[model samples]
Target chain A: MSERLHDRTRLRPPAPASIGDRVEDVGSPALLVDLDAFDHNLAQMQGLADAGGVALRPHAKAHKSVAVAQRQIAAGAVGICCQKLSEAYPFAAFGIADIHISNEFVGADKLAMAVELARHVNLSICVDDVRQVAAMASAAEAGGVRITVLPEVDVGHGRCGVNSTEALSRLADAIGEAPSLRFGGLQAYHGGAQHLPVWVQRRQAAQRAAEAVDGYVRHLDARGVSCPVITGGGTGTAEFDCQSGVYTEVQPGTYLFLDGHYGASEWLGQFRPRHSLFLSATVMSTARPGVVVCDVGLKSVAVDSGLPRLWSRDRSGWLRYVAANDEHGVLEVLNGDSQALLGSKLLLVPGHCDPTANLHAQFVCLREGRVVGLWEVDARGLSR
Target chain B: MSERLHDRTRLRPPAPASIGDRVEDVGSPALLVDLDAFDHNLAQMQGLADAGGVALRPHAKAHKSVAVAQRQIAAGAVGICCQKLSEAYPFAAFGIADIHISNEFVGADKLAMAVELARHVNLSICVDDVRQVAAMASAAEAGGVRITVLPEVDVGHGRCGVNSTEALSRLADAIGEAPSLRFGGLQAYHGGAQHLPVWVQRRQAAQRAAEAVDGYVRHLDARGVSCPVITGGGTGTAEFDCQSGVYTEVQPGTYLFLDGHYGASEWLGQFRPRHSLFLSATVMSTARPGVVVCDVGLKSVAVDSGLPRLWSRDRSGWLRYVAANDEHGVLEVLNGDSQALLGSKLLLVPGHCDPTANLHAQFVCLREGRVVGLWEVDARGLSR
Candidate 1:
């Protein structure tokens, strides 16, 4: 084996950017975080959360940066929520005091990792299955750590969690009995509702999710389980969640780094975030008559939601990103000036923020076309 | 800033795997490379290339592992073609002598990096623009190194490269006149043809690409520019490229690690690689009755092509990977034993191989369900 391949930690470096360099000089195909816009988004979400009297636990799963998470907490987030336990490691290692694995921890290895991580931070995890609860309880007991266990109530996403109040009651009862585990209320996240383009559709989904949380809180209360927290709301449904009157905490992640996918949504149009995440790709090939090819492609940005918007140009209405190869984005002229030079940088607003953020090694945090810092995507590839 | 966040090198690790560990004990959401099948694939591709009298340069953009690239070179591969210049660094640093950037290198930073890299290894880059040729010639001359240049020709993809023979001759004449560059050959890569579902469609596309290459090679030859090599083709079009009698070398990446997307295609069905790349996620939540939520989703696997197929069991046709959130793959039962327990390890054949491989930090190379070695995705995040 090659020695370089054997030891795996040396990541690809801070490409095309020094500490004092201008933004135009920063590397193509970079995950550019407009720190100015990010701060604005942070303040706006915090203000909304505060006005509604809900504690903001900004989901770190969107950006997965220790810096961003810390900033969110500094801006009055009660804590940060991670979608995976392993995803919370770098954050906890960086002294992120409180961390919650908003999603369930399944499997022995992962459960053990969660228990191990609990020793370092104020940790809480969601559980929907009795087996998951049992495994967590065992790991917590073995590790001699008291970890909070949130019983997940399936609040219309229909992906995971307990469906009925009876199921919630059973899981909550199991959690309450565990000496090493504390019952930490309900994990009632309406992920499906978070992306419904229609405002009314999203509101109704949030309402359904809220009702499920309310029904479970009532059920658990009657069964002598004090439900003090109900956490679940994303960038799309945070408004409804904060005003729901039941959720003590709302987890809104993508609001900070809103992308083209969320930007097009009428549901999230009210917040009107200044698209923080941008992919600045170099126009590598201008060989074709009226077309210029960009260096960013599917590998540079996530396309699960949709293609990134041409953020640098006002001709986006008709200037088409026709196709994308592994490392090339083909820009064709439909009506506008598509004659970009061979090395000009074109800003791309990522389609989806979270997965796109996870693809990059570091976020080129910029302010006014100048490099402020390079924030490591500390929890990138931490899917576990 | 936290010291850990700034340095950004020490990655998440449980590296250096021990043999004989059970598959269930492996970490959740891991990129598992079946070594047994991988070796078989190596032999198969070598044999196929040998029979066709064509060289195989397995695309490193698929795995980005120096170990895999070295293995390919050892097993009769000409070299490895990386999609990015920086991506080829770790491989070059690891003593894999020859590397090619299959994609265009734009921007002053990237071109300079490419020239600097040439001092260490045999470097070649593909370009279609005259300005790209001019810049590269200047860089090579200034650096006192000779770098090979492949003038890319658009076959049918229409993503990048020049179309006309007149343009090709112009770029070739520029390379021919340059003191620091060698006109290597044509980069007639039919990226579109590589993923066409039908065998006939792929063959036709390859034929068109071959004719275009022949036209360009003849055009260059008539102008006194010797064209010795022709490189292109991928897993889907490897057979067609090898048999085309025009391509001197074929670049097949995903053949070594076949995924669900390639498996569904009739083109690659003949060479069904033993789903080498597998994602084993824990059944984190099985509380939704018929639904089992695996803690592997868009973050773990690339959904650009399609959802992953349930691989550990034979019921993949019925056990549907219904939905995927940021960190959850919801597996539902259309018909089959979908009652996976909380800790049951379910294997997944990823949708697309390239981006899916890019998503993970390391590949847990497994032999007969036993942990072998941890292969680092060495060149990951080198998008620049």
Candidate 2:
């Protein structure tokens, strides 16, 4: 312990790289993505979808980049599922065809933007109200494009979507009446199920959601209306979604870059993807004997899930992200005998991936610990 | 309650702006700041600093806008406090003369960036260790620039900083020894106190932090050394900071845009400045009897503090942001008759203002329901 304290872990050794040094050469709190791991995760999801006879519509909201979406499509994804139209705008602009806004949009202005996007790409959107259908119709008419409509049905989680079949039919009928809109299917997603943590809890929740969708589909069929599609699923419950056999397409994101939170589970899966997001912070101060302060903080990383886990430490010291500031991260030397020397670089696996991805402008994509590519988070900060 | 719903509160109605409405004119979810109220908050803080005979170094992390910084400086702020060197890059790039990065910086690459930044702006950065001091000095020598250094001290928030005056003095001595470094004062910010909700808790926390600074200052005085600047205070404890006689400058950022979380508090003499951040999300679907789904969801508005409160709505309907998809917000309309009609526009006050502000690219600054200016969130997505 005395020897470890003498060799502080938080102080990263001087990584003296010239300005021309590739992005990867600049070490940890850097985000590292193993391309092999990423491709395996992608292929596994695709294979699962193909085996289940379902279309893979990967959600781009998890990884809000056109580059990542293009890769998903290359891996046989039917299209992309975007949570917001603003998020879809950039993807659509990048020629990501068959975009489904898996959320409801209400106002005329946003509807117009969606319609405008539909003109350039194949667009499908979800709605939980008749008025939203009318607004979409008007906007699509103005934009001279036909938009596919999915009536969002609440399958639990108590968020958005129609609570009952009656409300779903009403919204569907409203869509049928709109000249510029076509009934796509149904969006039956229970978002709360994604973070169940326990495999049994997650599976049960997905089964319950599927049961709700089954009821909705049967109700529509009884009324002589065929619901062509049922799109919903996430990384946390994609396997359960496929097993349920109710959802026609799964919108699983974050599988490409499994974060610390998702990785914490003991679920059996072959897709061990790499983390692509990082808050490359430097150790700024080490005045305290047992602690080291870093340049990254609350602003640098999203701590809603939990603190970042110390990734890739070569020393005896187990570094912990004990606290954070808007611009500083606190690393505590938990083990006195640990050798995480001062100025020694260390990787941190973020707790939650999505919010962490949203916190950056560009992803410094790496391969074999070398700077291979850099993709701009095109839809980042497009909150409108 | 029924009468209140029909009372037609004096809040501005959603303005129907066309697509041609130059980036500014659109209504709902737009943050409207009473500039007069803002100026008053600025002056009040400055007056306290003047009366207390202390330096007023406002934290720029709250506003993150160059324009706002100019206003703060105009109201008598000596210098601005930033959390990161990168966060301060934009302010420095825009020619905001003086800056103090209230956190430590460690990596050589980042140190070089700071050194590069110091070439233009008058910069002071915090340090918690000797190795970091060496790195900063190396970067400074490489860039041929001098940097002011402040040793971060741990008062509370066990996050970062040193606990001993001996360690602080040692780091200060190390900083002074550096060819391109100058020893500044101390940074004793109690981060945990910022969200105490209760004013007394916040005050008591600040008092303890002040006591730490007093210890350091007395030590410095005994050594025949004069510590000029002692910076650290946030929006929550800024009032108590002015009263404490310890903090030379108080860094409060959230006062410009009081969000639901901050405004929900009943702190004495605490002024409610104008709400300056909004997520201009459109209602996407409203088919359900008592629910409205919006285009903005977890991707658009952050729920780190909690879900955003529906702004300008009457108590007739208790609006709860019950769910969030990537692009959809599920607002549960509870109690009485739901006042939210289909396609009706609504404003939402975010739980935490900073992350929400960081989520947007532009600020549609409004006055009396009319767009006056469009400020780009320049430092937004600068998470790296």
DockQ of each: 0.52, 0.26
Question: TM-score for chain A of every candidate model?
Answer: 0.94, 0.90
TM-score of chain B of each: 0.94, 0.88
lDDT of 1 at B115: 78
- Tell me the deviation in Å of residue B283 in model 1: 1.5
What is the per-residue lDDT of model 2 for residues A281-322, given as tens digits with 9 covering 90 to 100? Answer: 555555566777665666657777788877665432566778
Listed in order, each prediction's TM-score against the native is 0.95, 0.87
| Best of the candidates, DockQ | 1
Alpha-carbon RMSD of each model: 2.7, 9.1
- Could you give the DockQ of candidate 1? 0.52
